[model samples]
Target: MSEQAGSPLEDLTAGGPAIDAFELLANETRLAILVTLWESYRPFAEDTTLQFSELRERVGTADSGQFNYHLDRLTDHFVDATDDGYRLSDAGLTVVRSVIAGTGIEERTLEPTTVDMDCKLCGSPAEIAYEDGWVYVFCTECDGLWTDRSDDERGQLARFSLHPAALADRTPEEIYAAAWLTTYQKLHSMIEGVCPTCSGPIERSVVVCEDHEDDGICGNCGRNGRGAARLSCAVCKEWVQSTLGSIAKYHPAVVGFCYRHGLELQYGVESLAQIERRLDEATSKVDLVSETPPRVDVTTEMDGDEIRVRLAEDLTVLEVSERTA
Candidate 1:
């Protein structure tokens, strides 16, 4: 095991040469060696490189053989040797970046808290969890033995590497994105098709409005505004109550029975089923819901010069005719 420095010296620690950009940080001397190298390459602060003996003095360690061992470990992390002396490898540079991001971890590296966990997937114990020793802590069933990402992360885009789907390798970011998208879809479904006006679910009701009979109306809104006719949108396939404005802009398809009709396409009616978008997808597309306001036709007699109109629901203006008598 490597030694670790408590403060700024952690940058020197590294896992295996392959696992982390820096994991061999546990040793004070080793950390010093890396820090010395860091100072040598610094933009300010004396930009000076020193030999092993000079490093020896700077690190002030008694054991020569031990110091050499630490230097060798640091050397292993980098393949590039600068014109003056040892430098970092490109892969080593990547380590420095990981260190900055605090993403680098060693294989089977003990954290401050040692938690013995059961193999979530195969019900294996911690021994097997670390048997192969991975940078990522995943169980095959509970989590795959991944490097940094969890199993669920890889599941979305054919990158999930299960024991069977080892071919499905994915990046931690990809996995995380998939997990988030799935959660978002679920959340959207929960809220979709819900009546914004009444806080009622969207799909279950079927009452129509007379005003915008073309777009389907919300049951709560429709029943409240019972005189209005209602139907579904021809273009977007959403249910909306008929409104004077929506009626002017709406396009309606012959409501096909048994998932029979849809937008005009190659197979027209046959293709409509595919276009019907399963209930899940339809709901998923629902936007942020706010209750649809009941259309109120406020009629105040205008003195032929101006009519007082009530506006609600954002940028909407409706004009009611003044009594002509």
Candidate 2:
């Protein structure tokens, strides 16, 4: 196998000539071919083949010679030819799917609406809007934009429609709690090993909130808190955080236990108490020897599994392990 075929990451690495790959895809005919092949590869299907004549007809090009030339360009990198016919390579499928999704987001229009929040800086009305697949809350008076991108397209729309009046009967704290819950769901998905933004690997750590001295203010959101558990995408560096208590829900072991108990890990009287009890039990197993930069070595056993976790000063899970025995 060639060096390019040795590893998938090599295709886009700095060492690789990615510009050549991009240049090859910079043609309409080649893109059409990729799309055709991708569509033919149906879910749960055994075959993804399209005859050369069929592919030519689908692309709708008149000249066979020109079509062959364009097809040749993508042959080794994006397209594969077999005794049966032609199909998109793995890289081809990824590129075509990304292009289709991006085009959908760009072409889709969202109506802007005024939100109920007053600008913290100017005390004026704020507006919520969706653009380029991101949801934005902007203060018209202060021109402050707080942008959030959801894990999925549907969630993005739902977040934009979450007006204060939507939950008119709920209290202010309840509203904030609902919003926070949405944020936590996205955070949970990211910390569980997949980044919602780019589908990349995520790294979780515990950090002292800059406002730790002021009773745990989140430096990112300016919310008053004690400390935060931060999770950042390894590929995109998109970072998110929550209070230590909230972040604990991102733990795999905790999530598993919650799943087994038929418990929805949301912020509520019963849920919080359950989480606190579990955390306390996990904490009691730890032996702490340091205070300045707090460190704890702890173990927890749940659902026929044993987990050993080491925590940093800010309550980040520095290391974790599970044993079946």
Candidate 3:
């Protein structure tokens, strides 16, 4: 956290100090200092620094010389030393928050349980499960959303990232909704040329299948759909890939169409199931309009009205046309 104002591109590409950040945090005492500083952090307070003696007492490290040595090791990079005392730097705060969020800690797993919603594809009952930091939803019958995404080869409907903290004070159905909403927000941000993780600019491109097939699982491309939008943030290296229909889910034309059809993309388990159903149905008609300039037209049909969203080379909404089927 230097006082210098650096652009995101400069921050990613510029060469800086040769210090190894991981090597600096390898000590137990150094990590304890960071956690203690985070414990005393107050956002709006005028003074939030912890004195040397107070921090040492809370960490329970008796040796004064050893404590000072560890504190000096963290200065400027992780912890900031001030005239009054010490406070956590921006990097230190990030580390502590990530640790508390259970990023590296394997907390628990949940077995697949039948959800209250049914599969949009086959109308069979859908199941939800949590394992290894991902929430999965799949149909028990015909290919839910895709066929080959799971190890057990269940009809995978959705798989999104979820931390262990989401399991607290919530049921399995609620957990699915939370994960779905989070992923929806991320996808919307990515489609708008922003990184959902770091708020940096993103680059987008479409991957079109040469020989497309769409009978549950595609035999030509191996994916369930004809094209996917891939996004990458150069600053943070955050990556996201989704079907063309998913990227266009929040378009005003599409939202209006769903509204007319009685599908509300709200924040709930049932609403998420509706959204998934819409995506599954929309993928069936995705056409690769052009390969040289990379254009994809996604079609959504319901109630005898058809709406097509055309995405240009950059994946931005190029046009919206409606017709009666």
Candidate 4:
């Protein structure tokens, strides 16, 4: 019925376009949970990995139950639980990186930025830039700004499916082949050397489930929230989720998969930096490879799953219906 003129939270949400992404961290507890990531980086830099138990310790709130509730909320926001501990989600990393740059909704809570580098998007070198809690990179060529609130690599992978380049110099059928192959690789990596439930030859792959509680049966699991944590294209780091994958797959690259009932693209990775490096190498020389029709089940690691057998498709697991020795 009524609104204020100078509400601080209002200014925060002034970024209506990015509202979905930041909504996760909007809560005070969730914001604190995200800050824990920065803590994880300093003490365990040598460990080179963030652990959930460590996060629990660093976040040491009064109520263990309440702390866990916040942790789960934050987990759903940007991290995932694995046997190894809670690892930062790609979105989680984007949030953390933004915090490091003194950007993002929570950046104001931290000290100002000191480190400097060329704008990742624009190429013009600069230092001390922050906005909307996102470390922004401006491109001299296009005046593009990839926010620290976002991850360029994460964005590109999301778009690569229909990305003209993803299907480049090839027929639509061939593009699907590359897309399928890419999907396979992603699933292979996440199955973790074998199925957690079964010792049989488990492979990572996409599946269709009409029984899902969310939007239109979804293309795959963990993809419904693409709108929340979208980042700039990994290679160009200019466009916002404009890779071929987003256009064709109708999903972010990190969350793509195959669904006869619907298409999927579950390409979400643990580390944006690692995925960025890999895709950069592939995209640079892919000018000619794009012309070739895609084959194999899962050669492109980032195409679908983590990194296991360099799988081409996890869907094959359904066909085999049994694990291998």
Among the numbered candidates, top TM-score falls to: 3
Cand. 3 Cα-lDDT: 0.79
Where in model 3 is the C-alpha error above 4 Å? 1-19, 42-47, 104-106, 147-150, 256-284
Model 3, 8-94: lDDT tens per residue? 546545544533576688899999999899989999889889999999999999999999999998998999999999999998898
Q: TM-score for every candidate vs. truth?
A: 0.25, 0.54, 0.82, 0.28
**1-325 per-residue lDDT for model 4 (tens digits):** 4558887667765766356666667777777767666556453454434575667677667777887787776665587776666666667776776555433233231122222233334345332322332222233333232222234322111222222234225433333345444433433332334422223343232222233334421333333221221222223232222222222222222233232213223343323333333333222100111112211222222333331111122222211111112
Score each candidate by Cα lDDT: 0.36, 0.59, 0.79, 0.38
RMSD of each: 24.4, 11.0, 6.1, 18.2
Tens-digit lDDT string for candidate 2 (1-325):
4565557656556444566888898899998899889878986688888999999999999999999999999998999899999998878887877676556523543355565445443566655554544444555654232224434221111232232232435443344344445566667777577887678988876554332334232337443433346678888686675445445445676566555645445445223244334433332133443445765555555555555666776456777666765
lDDT of 3 at 210: 75
Give model 2's TM-score versus the native structure.
Answer: 0.54
Runs with alpha carbons beyond 4 Å of true place in candidate 1:
1-23, 43-48, 100-325
Top candidate, metric lDDT: 3
Model 2 residue 208 distance off true place after TM-score fit, in angstroms: 3.0
Task: Give per-candidate clash totals.
Answer: 47, 3, 0, 51
Tens digit of per-residue lDDT, candidate 1, span 1-325: 5546664345434334334533566667766666556546654444355666777787788899988787787775643445565654555454454453333233222221112333333454322121122222333332232223333332111121112111134333333233323332332332244332234444322222334322322223322223322333233343333222222111111111112322221122122133223211211111111236533332222122212333233313333222233
TM-score order of candidates, best first?
3, 2, 4, 1
Global local distance difference test of model 1: 0.36
